[model samples]
Target: MRRYGPALLLVLVGAAILRISAFSALYLRYVQAGLRPYLIVSGAALVLLGIAMAVVRRSADDAHDDDGDPLDHEHGHAHHGPRVAWLLTLPALALLLFPPPALGSYSAEREAAQRAAQGVGVFPALPAGDPVELGVGEFSSRAIYDSGRSLKGRTVRMTGFVTHGDDGTWYVTRLLVSCCAADAGTSKAEIRGADALPADTWITVTGTWHPKGKLGTDAAWPPVLDATSVERVEQPADPYEKR
Candidate 1:
């Protein structure tokens, strides 16, 4: 068992990765969809490597036994290292049995302040529609930086989890990730006309822009939406917006 400890940890980790990346959409919680293929390949490699390692070690052990050698007599001091190494498999087991949830209100609320846009200008005209479906990040960008007022008079819809401010303010929030969850940024809109729902509740909001402060100013940040309708919805399979 000690001889196979390292190989077992590798297999457990590989199995956990495969469980999320190849067998389900659960990988989206920590990485972008485009990364799924890489993850699948890595998992397969780990599994094969582990199996090969275990086979090689077994062959070596059998050779030692055939020579009438005591397996632990000469390496008794090294045995403790393998025993301690078994603890490394706990993280792999946790990933298999209890994969973590996607970032939600708690992650959003941790943002100290919204980062300012690099530049302010007119964005392309929105497609013609009664209610335009927009990502939370896109809406926030247009609201704060568009000098041409792209969102004005437009009924826009966005879906995100709910988060609350200390002042009793609530927001429709989503996290934006450039590469993965570790680099996530928050985007949200303060809802003006609707009652606050429980934190982390996924909701689709339809509303018109409620202009606040001057465009491109910190005071204009977060933006505002006068929600005519707010309906609870199931969380999306891929929760983070691509940054």
Candidate 2:
């Protein structure tokens, strides 16, 4: 067992990486699609490194040790195995036992940077149709940055987790990632009549946009939604949007 320590660590690390990328949508919680290939490459490299190390170690075992000593090696000392390598399995085991849920109300309730802070500029043209369904990030962009106030009369549908604002106001929020979770920005809307819903509940809301504060400027406040309807929905496969 001790002889295989370094190889085992490499294998476990590789396995963990592969698990996140393949087993579930767990990878989506931490990163966007652009990064998936890199993870797979890294995992494969680690696995190959692990296999190579094992082969080399086996080749240089007792048969090749200097002076017929079981542990003597090129460093002129006993080659003890990598005891700390055991720590490598921790992340693998943890991820296997409990793949983390997507960024949810528990975290969004804390409310990081709002869409205003993201410095979004002119929003794109609205889609063609009533109650146009849009991602939370896109919806917030139009509500806050579009000078035309494109959402004034149009009903739009957004899906996100429910959370509470600093003022005990209920909001539907989604985390928008530019690259990964480390850079996630928040997009949220104050739900005018849906405060009764529990925090963290995932829902689809159809509503008209009404800004809580001034729009077309950089004032920090959630976009307002006078909800016409809200329906409980399953959390999306990937809870984040690439901005």
| Most accurate candidate by TM-score | 1
lDDT of 1 by residue, 1-243 (tens): 777888988999999999999999999999999999999999999999999999998886676666764555355325535466778999999999999999999989888875954578999999999699999999999999999999999999999999999999999999999989999999999998999999999999999999999878899888999999999999999999998
- lDDT values, one for every candidate: 0.91, 0.76
The positional error of residue 102 in candidate 2, measured at the CA in angstroms, is 2.5
lDDT of 1 at 168: 93
- When summed lDDT is taken over every stretch of 10 residues in candidate 1, the lowest stretch is 73-82
How many residue pairs of model 2 clash at the backbone?
0
Question: Candidate 1 — what's its lDDT?
Answer: 0.91
lDDT of 2 at 185: 72
What TM-score do all the candidates reach, one by one?
0.95, 0.85
lDDT of 1 at 2: 75
Output the worst ten-in-a-row residue range by lDDT, candidate 2: 111-120
